[model samples]
Target: MASTICYCLWFSYVTILHLVSSLAKSDNYIIHMDLSAMPKPFTNYHSWYLSTLSSALDNTDLDTNNLNSASSRLIYTYTNVMNGFSASLSLAELEALKSSAGYISSMPDLPIKLDTTHSPQFLGLNHRTGAWPAAKFGQDVIIGVVDTGLWPESKSFKDDGMTEIPSRWKGQCVNSIGFNSSLCNKKLIGARFFNKGYRAENPNITIVNSARDDTDGHGTHTSSTAAGSRVDGVSFFGYAPGSATGVAPRARVAMYKAVWYDHAVASDVIAAIDSAISDGVDVLSLSLGYDNVPLYEDPVALATFAAMEKGIFVSTSAGNDGPDKPLHNGTPWVTTVAAGTLDRELRGTLKLGNGVSITGLSVYLGNFSSSHFPITFMGLCNNDTELTTKAKGKIVVCENFIYSSILIQEAEAVGAVFISNDSDSSFGHMFPSIIIDSMNGDIVKAYIKKNSDSTASMSFKTTALGTKPAPSVDSYSSRGPSKTCPFVLKPDITAPGTLILAAWPEKLQVDVDNYGNVTLFNSFNIVSGTSMACPHIAGVGALLKGARPDWSPAAIRSAIMTTSDIFDNTGRFIKDVGEGYKRATPLALGAGHVNPNRALFPGLVYDAGVQDYVNLLCALNFTQKNITAITRFSSFNCSSPSLDLNYPSFIAYFHANDSSSRRVQEFQRTVTNVGVGQTTYVARVTPIKGFRVSVIPNKLVFKEKNEKLSYKLRIEDARMTRENEVAFGYLTWRDMKHVVRSPIVATTLKLES
Candidate 1:
């Protein structure tokens, strides 16, 4: 009874503390001012946005200088995509602005919570690591990366021994704070920034706008991964120590700073895309996006479609909201990339007082004594609890429900152990701690509860190299069956995104430990995300562009997707690390892990031009007016329905009730011969369990290069499963030397029809 009462009191104290903390934060002085209503219909987005902001500021009684600096005071404005402006203003000031004009709803810009090397060989791009590819190293191609910004001073951006800049490049460097024209060398040909939206979104914070200068390491890391110059001895504290080079090391980078402090405003990103397209970049690399929205409503998708029409390839991240999360901005025109793991892992171990040692994972670089110490739970270490002294030098076990780092810090424990719901192989903690799985965590908790002198020892290990069964889909890499466009498969391919070692901005790569110890590295660090994967494919796209100068964006995308390998190094089918180590499906890994060498020589490509995409837009249920607005075409006639987009992969969507259990779906596709002439490829369909799939005119014979052949794919499903059931298969076009593959997925999603 005493224990129960004590537990109740402790829980009550925590609940009250949390409530008080929330109230304290809610009562803070600075307030989030939001302009909710979208302005009246306007043709020009920028003009209307600037005018609305000016009018809002005009209502204020500030001096001329303050009024003129309204852009600086603004946080973020929603112009083209949605509507609204978020800023840091007092309640009265916000109300004044809202009452002024063109304001509806008011809210805060709530803080949204925000891989490389051996990957080259893993993707069969071993030749790119050296000079074997010769002039094919993306020589004249320019890759425009839209992200945080660039770090010009990194050795990877040096223009040493670089050739003359491409004549087609019409870009220039913008001078902002620390950024200068000198940073734009032959290698990094252009640098620009869009921050009006950022400033409008973050008026309370005085952030430096250094043009394309990257304060956070995200932009620098991605840009370097896409086209960094070859640098020897690049690594993060001796880990991954070796020569570091991008897939297209010689590709020129045009930096566009659209993301600010990890959050990108839709208007700012669209502006950046427009500028990049106008600047004549051969390829655009975007490592940022948000939740999935309709393609027509997505500014990024609309801009990218425009870019595709202009012959520039756009590669975007598949997003990090993982396991089975829907992909973001996963339009058919853009190359959506997913994250995959490499052959490297960093492991650590925990020794319990029961003389049992369990392996946990971590990348913590600090060293501690090997002796075991008494352990306790955070509940016992509460402020008024009797375990404060017991937790002083002991390792404390904390539930992963809250931030383990904060709990450990507050517990005053020498070391900490966090109970996680993730897999045992999961390991990303950076402190002197071990994140054990819940099962083992419970065991540790029980051991500690059974005896008052429970203790454990923790130790770190050197980076494990060639850690086998590699090239698996990263669990966090966003999955797809595109929420907006379910007929198309997203994440065109996966790339080495986990534990990737790449360039890091020196200024932002510093870490301070619990002992007031500061650790700094000069060049590179390990990071993981589909953001990392996007650049690998973008760099590959640059290489393909440099080689096949006449290849359309669709042709390049087709080449990469159709040629990607679905197997890992161990000759086993690649696993989706996100889906509990199950065999990866087409939805998890798209076409598979990107294979650069195979892509370079892909015999046949399912090609779709601008008109083809426009035809796809016509298939959607939008009115002709809406379609014209989306495609920027005045007279677009409706084409066939969704599945006939001539995509490299095939997907069939269905939603069947008990009355509509049996259904048939058909798709038409056209493939162009980019390979040797006089090649005959035969189609072979791998049957799905519950569906009958057939391809008409299975033999495709190409008499000459660039010849086109059309075929029909039909899927008949007879089984009635639960609603929204998804099944997968594949179709392979095989020749003597080439095997062009495409995934076939059937989904019982009625809306997809």
Candidate 2:
């Protein structure tokens, strides 16, 4: 009987495996078409696409006349972003499409991943002063956020002081299950979702029909951080209590739901960008990215180029894989942001039996007895049965911080002490818990080993403001010297991304207390990532747009970069928490932490337009076909290709052995005066080691506000070392009242003999 049961089970497993293999044979792919090469007979691109798809399908019965049957295989038909469509097709079908007319290229649909909250005062944004009043609090500036869905009931979305929706906005509030058009007021002008790709991939799984309702809380948090209205008396479980306001409080918000529960498909993201561009958003904020790929193949990069052509400013997060990793969304057109620390800390104290009190960070609010509990050391606290047996009624110490309080709670432990190497301090633990650095952790572990009755107790959480050496580059923020495009400096700027307080979905529970009760303030939560930092720049971009409606996207980016602050509040050079708290390099902090007030009147700005990007693509050695795929244009010239793309920062690559001969490279840049009338600007270069830098015509005299001036920067390598190394400096163009600074980086590569 047991043998017969085994045979039946084996048969069932084999049948299921065969079924899965059959389903996997057909995969999703994004097909790019050359619009210029479209057959003259086919007037409508949609009908042409249908005919083209039907020709490729194995089933001849699938024709354009049978619209339902033909459309069933299509995922998304992109128009504004790219001339393409995403569909599920077999290898045979893909080959047929390649052989058909107007096909540019095709790539298998890849998965994307999500990569904010902060004090407005930390960024020098105040209601009545500085850039806030000058820009009228970003009045009527529409910020389109493409991420997870949103929570309509959050107080941050209330249209208390908002004006009517902008007449230029052509977006609509899409109604779905749990969400309707009525939820979108003047503050939230539009909400839409693109999930056909996701649904096509996971055919059996059920997803919420509502695109406006956020369940994971990521979208709500990011959207609110960029343009949320002010909500007074906000806190996260009574921690960091204050009025929470987005960087641009009065700017309108429009959400495009592309990221779902786990991951986002590239096709869906492209569709979202297409919709945002067609809907007329002034600024686009995307807090998600995938691995680094070439510009020609990156869907986000391609779509953003189109948005830039339409005069829309794009802000994207540098990926979360940081400390030392290649950054994603490295396109020159978008304002890529890196994560930094805020001046706030959630403080918690851990008291030992020997009277040694160590203060760390936590967001724990559960009550703990004053009496110290017996302490025990667990390597990682990963084994559940062992923990339940040995850690009952005691304080458990862990070597790693990832073990949640639920594990300790399930083990019946009174509290937990996590020792971590990371500087993160935003975790909310249900049980009384605290996270300390590895050095402090050693002290606790040693104390437990020495005494027979070692015990420890944790205090409640407290908020600490004005922490020193803030605005430091976070250890988790991605770094630069982009491998894909080494000529351009990535992560254009850094902003407050750690311990940011913002609106959250009220229904989502953060954590539960000792008695299994939810202890979180449902309306708000603190999150950290490059994701949070991206929206800060997006909000700043909106403020710039509101203040100077005539400024292009590149002008806004240049202003933000040139007028950034390299020094922290303590008047010390900003540091990097990643490299043992060393002075941050341009690769880590970009131009430096963003300063909205200084960015408002940057005196002079470096501006680049669609033609400039086309030239850049040509300089990158991309073929005409590849350029057409990315730019959606049929004709482009590579005759005057130059690596110097007139960017905000300068980066020069050299060989280490070239020291014998002084290798000199020159870069040309043009700046337009945006400040007061008749300004004389002088150039000054911070001397870099092993290099001599000079600027021709060091003095630039602008006769009028709109006058444009050009200059050439020449760098000569003097004493290049044998090892691969990097040197950093700055080129500052200063008038009497304004300083326009750009970072200069020189990298030396070792050559083989």
Candidate 3:
């Protein structure tokens, strides 16, 4: 009885704490402010618990003290705004709200909960590391996925959390909706064509009823990788698993169909960007760009620049033409994400020479199943670098790293029976690829070297295989240092952009799958790409922006870059990304993979703001020649280049002078956080074993909450004037009297003369 009473008291206390917000939503949908405390919203997760807050509003048994002490409580509500809306933001309302007493103090950064899993056409790459560290819950930052309209009811994409379509996108009424095919009916969604950038009053576009409709299904998959909620054990594939979710999930999404009928033009893309900005989206992730495309001088390039100027962080695909000439859209300006393979083993095995002799492991070259032909294991190649040999009537087992397509054409054509590929990135091991049981290739080599003769006499065995069924980075997604524009490192970074599943048309699924015997959890799929990673980054951006509402775009980027994880599975620095020649190999991380928690407390950040971008565009002179690019859906505005995409502070940077090439100059970001209370703390710098960090001032102080502090960090060493190098280092503090902490860097720098 005592225990029961205590439980009841606890329940009452928890419920009472949310009393204020309880009154706002009669439904049990409650929202907690603390990033750590917030629970994921489920189609069925909050149905019952929500009553506690709402019940009090009706009755008067609520305890005011509990409500007062609760950090923050908000009624969760979603409204469809696809079609045009009559509501207007009055200037008076804005002024009054800004003037409101507690407004400034209470404001937080915008959220980054993008819906990455909207399409089903991803490669299902499961990249779940080197991302922001939170409870792993999705965030609530709004993203404008200007692609196909979302069909919330499809069985393949049933679990999508879309509440309703937007009002502004209430396209021409349609009758049917679908998922598999392009257009099932018109009334289901609101789709308006904003394509074919022309010099006319209205562009050649049409409006049709749709449910976030998609034709190619690419956009749908991309969006899913960004924000699809967890349904199965963890995630479909992309990063942000467990308690750590996408940057935003509770945030709104504005979907636009840009590449309808498998076509995309500068006008269409520009219109989409303009439309997104007008809709007030926080970030824009577009995984589309072309080679030999125009520069900031071109409409497409200029459009991208404009978006950045508006304080919006634009993430584009680095382009697919890798290991080839004329780079893809791997420009340094955009947050271009590239693809890399993940494996458990450093070496693999192949059957060369005889019909039945298992000598040792070789690198994977493709075939794994149905080995009807004779096979033998070859010995380990050196350093697991390159493998060579002659296999006539036998099979060759190659480690992943080498695209099977090449081996398929070469070996098979020369009388080789079959091939085996070893890769382990969850689902990325499709086709002939084999998984290398958690052990690395080095281990396999060591084992072979230890038992050289025994293995040489052994025959091929299927038992010595590995598998993980999760997706991995696609070899064909795209590469950076864009061929067309090598000066700019095409893809700035990589994120989860692959085979993803999101909200699909309800009418498309025959019978959606459910968890156990329930109908609550619906919709899910696998995916891959920079598209996937873009939303992941965007979500982290939202979280950090929320924590430090005043940070500029550049600052956010800097936080993500500097504090990113910069090591490979082997704990070594990722190698040169194929193209773009830097006197030195640029770190795989232009800054590094994003670290949201670290970003929240990053001692320094490069601040990119809208004004900074304006200056960049002004000097570069990237202006539009036509006005019809904007949608009729929005009230058009024409002004100087100052009003382009609110470029974040970081996007404002330009190459230093005296060089024809637009090379980036050196810059640094410094931060000091109160990891503790009032007095000062000791500072230290211990970089990752293989990396180095240069800390300026070397030591600093951290104040308590409600108190602000500052520090001075030098850019380069006083002894030498390095022309174009960023001064990198770590800043640490321990046993401080006040809040003090150094940030997390992915690597330790090796001193070089």
Instruction: Please provide, for model 3 over 1-753, each residue's C-alpha lDDT reduced to its tens digit, 9 standing for 90 to 100.
Output: 999999999999989766545443222221222222224552221222223223323243333333321112222211110111011112222233233222221122233333233221111212343222232233334456655555434332332554454343423323333323333221123233454452232345553334354444555545544544443433222222222223444334445666655566676777777777666555666767666654543444556555666666666665555445333554334566554332211122332122111112222223344334443334331222222344434333334334442443234322121222322222222222233321223333343455433221112212111112212334444543333333333344444443333443322331222212322222333334454556666655655554555555565665555554444433454433343211112223333344455555554333444444433344333344322221121233334443222211111112233244323222233343423445454556544232333444555454563344444322222222223333333344444222222232221122111
Q: Which candidate is the best by lDDT?
A: 2
Estimate TM-scores for all models. 0.77, 0.79, 0.50
* Tens digit of per-residue lDDT, candidate 2, span 14-121: 998776455436779989988787788975565567677767774432232322333456654544225767777766567777887889999987763101234578
Candidate 3 or 2, higher lDDT = 2
Clashes of 3: 196
Residue 697, candidate 2: alpha-carbon lDDT? 90
Model 1, residue 474: C-alpha shift (Å): 2.2
TM-score of 2: 0.79
Candidate 3: 10-residue stretch with minimal lDDT: 78-87
- Sort by TM-score, best first: 2, 1, 3
Clashing pairs in 2: 117-500
Measured by C-alpha RMSD in angstroms, how accurate is candidate 2? 28.5
